[model samples]
Target: MLIINIHPTETAWSFVDDTASTCSIHHYSKPIPMETIRQESRILYLISPGQNDLQLAPEEQRTVSQQAPHIQTIFRDCLRANPRADHRLLSENRFYQNLPPLSTRYALPADLATRFQRAGRDALTHQWAWIKAKSILPEVKSLISIHLNSAPNAVAIKNGQPVDLSAGFSQMDGLPGFHSCGEIDPSLCLTLSEKGEPPAAIEHLLAAQSGLSSVSPELASFSQIFEQPESLASKVLSHQLKKTIGGMASALNALEAIVFSGEITPALTAWLVDLLEPLTAFGFIPTSTISCESITRLNSPASRIQVFLMEDTPWKIAYEMFSQAQPLQS
Candidate 1:
């Protein structure tokens, strides 16, 4: 089987042998023959982020560069609400999992989530069209399907489902985002609004202009903060990541391995490991580092848990999804 991953940032295609392992891999360029897809039994696994899983008709395949105001309206609705939690709960449970519900995250309204999904429909369809234009294959076009799986950075398969997600979702209740503020005190939103700060203004500030950039003038982007390790931006990011990973592990009740795949994650590895190892008390350090032209595992002997460095997680998950799905009758 041939697995081609078209991610938001990079693209890679791999040939898988009988053992279901990648045999040969090509990166950032198309090396395979276009006729090969039509001539052989193959599947194309696309990992276009922020795209819906529903396949669209060819006529509906145009992408939108600007998000409609309505979408942001729905996003802003998820921001903050009237204050509710008492100070006692906040003070007593400074530890993760025990922190007040309003501290790190909020329950996103279902209708609002759906609205966001609907708004991105055209964008996802446009992505499929873009991939097809480059490949020039008609036979396997229908084979392209959406993997409902999502995650912040990498793709994780749990309970037979993909866990990929866009920003503003609360998977990382404790993890602060780059420009968007990290998890915050929910009531803070209410207080800000009371002082004449509109809900929309707060949302824009958090989503567009906060986090690392809000902290200091020098750190405007993740790359900027990445370069300035001793700076305050790096310090806060490190703290937030550590807390979030620990909280997630605790909530899930298991911690066996870590896979890092995303636009920025693979690049921020050494820094992430330093932050992860201290809080994690596990003893199963990786005995050897794994690497390949295609897929590989990173992590030195002292680091615990098998660490996989996938070129593209969505593509991997999409392949698994397509392979697992029952074919439809003609």
Candidate 2:
């Protein structure tokens, strides 16, 4: 039985333990499970920071970026409004005082800070501490893997143990995430730092506030942009979709190898493959067909292909391919 703890977004973590055969998966919105409390198992936890939640719109982006200062002001006001709410830690204004130094290169605004503060607080409460506590379980057998978007050295160290990290499925080195600007010039960070940008702001731009959000004007939803596409934004969206499909295929192939090698059952393999198909499709194709070549390329112990054709190109043909497969259960 494998216990997979996946942080779907940088701000949230979900735990899916495959041990019970029934496969119970839980979002980290409440208290840790009793099983987690009792097992004391050394769980394999993966962390990939700087991922985005649901896509935002252009107006939201502009408001967040342009009105960043006002947003920060409001955030501070919110803190001040709740005088008894840990004002000491919140009063320092680190998030605001630290912004200009950070946005020199990326032009971050106050709304981002406010959103981060809110999301970060919720994430810490519902996910991080809970996982940290669970990590001490004696029943946990192994610390198998970790994922991170940035360098592992940057992650906070606690009790001298390095957190296992993976850069997430989207961050395959050069592959851009939903909101990352993707790979940057190596000297870019040095240049930004030398110019006196705050480390926090640099980190924020590099991880949280880049990617699709940078290109699209609408902040609330990428789907909105797709519905009414302009030339430039449409191109960016197309590229991002292609990259996403490639990444999903890569992850699927990796999982398939494990299953095919007898590490997991056929049923589990089928279940995962079916589950991810819709997500990978993203309206580009209704269904996806995995070819033997793609599977072999992805699973080859020595092969290192970064991209592959998972299905026929042209939405019409791809949709037809999807129709031929067993309908994916909703």
Candidate 3:
């Protein structure tokens, strides 16, 4: 089986053998070759961030099936609100679980294929958050996965399923991402358009030029804000992060843990103390930091809620999913 993960920043593929043991892997910063996909002999599966036509697990497929009717209305509302909104968000509600597997004989629709090429790439850190929560506390029922990277999101997990998402309808609606504008009043977008700004230009400004970097040119990544903690950019991000996480934590009826994933670094760990201060009222306290690709507990011993750090990338999870689904495909 061949698994392909396409992101805006990079593209990767792995060819796994029937036994799910070993396979050749290739990842490139350049676009994946169309010819390679067209010519591959093995069955192919795609895992793209923010893609709607996904081959979700059986459970997710069932959820999509039950809720599919509302998607068209959601898409229409988003378009009416933001004329230049990215199609990925509007289209993501559909499930492609029963669709034909990618092969020479079966091709993706042109629009869906283009989204795979343009979707923002993240580690799918929410899934790892759930894994860490389950590992540390098997009885854990509810937790929120906070991903603060190029494309930030907070997902509330309950019983191993997503109960709420901060990146509602689009990745542009959640906490301000490193580059994305996050949410803005529709009136503001309208105001900009009235001032002679093209809708396309406004969309590019919000989607590409806003967020941390928009606050300060040096704030390219989440970690860099720590270098100038006193800067306006740093303060803005801190406030936004705190507000977003607090709301998510408050939403859950039985919050047991909080998982911080995606772009976890030493700077982020060192800053967790101050970052989570407000949340202490919610029974979360900061603890010592451990930097690794594996999941590690980051909450103090006395804290009632568990806090974790998971730095593992999404590729590992994608591989595991493909491996598990291989037999079902047969």
Candidate 4:
């Protein structure tokens, strides 16, 4: 099976053969020749992060592709590269067959970070965290998983499936990311535009120059913020994260677990869980300090809710989810 994950900044492709041999390219440096893939009879799946959660009709697909031309071009080239190979659009119920599409009354916009709210980015960042959260606390009925990364977002899982997300019409709507201002008043954007700031310039500022990094120019990433917990940037991020988690928790009547994932080191996990200890209602009191490991259990055995820290790469998680959802013959 071959899976290609598409993102705004980069593209990644992975090939897993019958023997489970895996080879991959994770940057936009070079393109994979379709002829190599067509040499064997195999399935090729093209995936765009949050798009998998939406069920679109044939016409809707065309509309969405038009809005996201980069994605559309990739799909077109892949199709032409291997005209006879089995190609799948791996979206909506096509992947994660057990999980239903999120329920919402509003019509979803195109999958662009700038135009409207979309999960394509969040799906890449949070889907794996959601899967890891469920695996760690398999029996929890209601759960909230927080992903702190370059493009951070939170997911509310009920009955072991995603039911809600913090991301709004765009990746910029949810929790503030490393550099992007998560949620802000719409009037502020208009105010900037009226001041003669071009739309592209405004986007670059909000999506690239704001958020945690804005608090302290020296702190460029979440990793750095966690490293210097006493820094102004770290303190500001801590305050914001606590508030975001609290708001998400309110949406669920009965919360059982809180899992932390994405671009975190073991020290960051322990530090974050300790900072969030005030939310006693969700059982975050650790019997002892969490160990600095890739995966750690932070809660005590007697707590009403379980707290955990697990780390896994997004690409690995996405490939696993897709492979499991639609297994192909060797």
Candidate 5:
């Protein structure tokens, strides 16, 4: 089995150099040895092999084509030149066709496009297209995995055991992903969509346009505002920060139990605890310790907590309880 490690920054070919007759030298980069390569070979890994992760605009395309001519050229050359070689290129950006019907470019505002044009272009999109088009090997299955700042809601669980969807979903529920809103108001979505807005626009509003941006107009980032002194806005900001931390902690705990197991080191546990500290301070449910326990307890065959958590019933009770508990503060 040929194992190829394609990084996001550079493309490196790894194969037994059969050309060398005396002792076949393993033709892998000095930076990454052949032994390390073997360790990561249980699952197939593909990378886009680009410098940075940045979405480019239409105008910046020309400059990128000029500067990173070799990136795309190498990709095309690799698939075309070496058809038999088993390799996968990892990318940060999604690719779409440039010509007529095939092309449905990212729908963004003109101002955003102009800003992106000023920034340097990303070679990921181009590399993705080239790989998809040329690589037609029957053995190679095209698997695309995107790593976001947040945790994923779904993950493929691979073991000697049979493939199970229930197991995957159960593992996924604890994780906070980029796409998931993490305790969203279904009524808000229904109300917004009822007004005849497009589904795509609603999706963008929920995913990209909401959160910290919606809350703070003056501040560009949540971290910047988080540094400010206590105020009504700061309190709200604190709450948001706490909630985010809780979600992240829950995700890490779930991942540890289902995937990492003994591999879950002290550093990882520390990171998870650190994330949950703010949430604990804010009186949000302690996520790190009770996350898995809560999932198990709430999802039991005979449990009322599941219904409460699922349908926002507990939120009402919590609000009332808080109101009664701290009347003077309220």
Candidate 6:
């Protein structure tokens, strides 16, 4: 059996032929280039790993040597351009990279930083190994994971080819990325520091224990808050997402679609669509349920934004990686 994990900045895998042996690792900065996939246009697709979640059709199931494509330059801005820290790489013994950069001089300046460089590299190693195990060559590059689901457009067939309507772009990550408090007033940290809350501790609080968790003690994780939509927690999440989505909408002028994926996607999308205030909710979904059942249409049909809830992003990344590799090997 082989286990593979895909993350925003890394991928990891382990082949258990020798249970006692430790899993080996590999790394790569860029994904298989986009131009490469367009030229070769064939891949040996992998089976859909998701069965319990959203199921892709027989033809929809991920394929190897598939001809898929996407192009939109200004549209490309929608892709994830993470914190500078994510791009940092360490060539010397592979240390001090992949961690979100700490701004000691910034408003909330810190004296020290705890890095996750090794963890990022390890993940890449295992992911590449899985690629090699399948007799694949050339490293995988581009990837788009929403709610951890990476299916291409279900209704995008035209001229016998699927179109990239969304340009594989995503919302602003690290805008309080799940746990991290994206950007905050430096005064809060300074005030905390003045009150004798150690700077490192303050950083820890903001980085790990902030965001949705900061607002409630009962909510253990974002998944819990989104999954169990009962009271203020759900309302709070809905409000936050609304503001974020609204800001994004303003910047883009208009949205064609919205894909919500990851562990919390189902609950997040449902609760948000259901709690779009009464008027706003009515705008998105005309008839919602008491239990807040999953809704395909949260907004009016005329409205442009189409929301989707998906799962299994790791597999999606695998396809993107494989697609990129196809052209190079050919």
Whole-model Cα lDDT of every candidate shown, in order: 0.41, 0.31, 0.58, 0.64, 0.31, 0.35
TM-score, model 2 to reference: 0.29
lDDT measured at residue 70 in model 1 versus the true structure, 0 to 100: 34
Model 3 stretches with alpha carbons more than 4 Å out: 6-11, 15-44, 49-124, 288-293, 322-330
TM-score of each: 0.49, 0.29, 0.67, 0.75, 0.29, 0.44
Per-residue CA lDDT of model 3 for 1-330, tens digit only, reads 455544323546665555654455787665345544444444334434334323234465567555554334333533344343222321112221122222111144765443332122232455555765686789888887887667776666677656555553345555777777886776989999999999889878888888878888866566787666777877777788777666766767776787877556666665655777777787877675465446666787888888777764544555444422322111
Cα error, candidate 5, residue 72 (Å): 3.9
Give candidate 3's whole-model lDDT: 0.58
Task: Give the best candidate by TM-score.
Answer: 4
Expressed as tens digits, the lDDT of each residue in 229-290 for candidate 4 is 88887777677778766766776766677777755476587577667678765565675655
Better of 2 and 6 by TM-score: 6
Q: In model 6, which runs have C-alpha deviations exceeding 4 angstroms? A: 1-11, 14-174, 177-179, 264-269, 275-303, 325-330
Model 1 reaches what TM-score against the true structure? 0.49
**RMSD (Å) per prediction:** 16.5, 18.6, 12.7, 5.4, 19.7, 16.8
- Highest-scoring model, lDDT: 4
lDDT of 2 by residue, 1-330 (tens): 112232323112223233322223445554344454334322222222233321223345455345435324433543343333211111111111221222112234766543332111112111222232233332322221111112110111122222221122223223344456665675888999999999888877877777655666474543333344453544554454344434433433331111111112233233334323443333212123333431211222332221111211112211222212222111
Q: What's the candidate order when arranged by decreasing TM-score? A: 4, 3, 1, 6, 5, 2
Candidate 1 on 136-252: residue-level lDDT in tens? Answer: 322221111111111222222223222222123322222455666756777888999989999779888766676666676676566655566778877876675555445445543
Model 5 lDDT per residue over 1-330, tens place? 222335444544433222311222244433344344443322122333243223344555446556665455544544444444443433333322121211112245767533332111222322222232223222222211111123222111112111111101111122222332433545877888899988888777766665444555465543333344333333453454444334433433321111111112333333334333433333323232322311111122232111001111212212212211211110
**Candidate 1 global Cα RMSD:** 16.5
The CA lDDT at 267 in model 4 is 59
For each candidate, how many residue pairs have backbone atoms clashing (under 3 Å)? 9, 30, 1, 7, 6, 24
Candidate 2 residue 78 C-alpha distance from true site, Å? 43
- Which has the better TM-score: candidate 1, or candidate 4? 4
lDDT of 2: 0.31
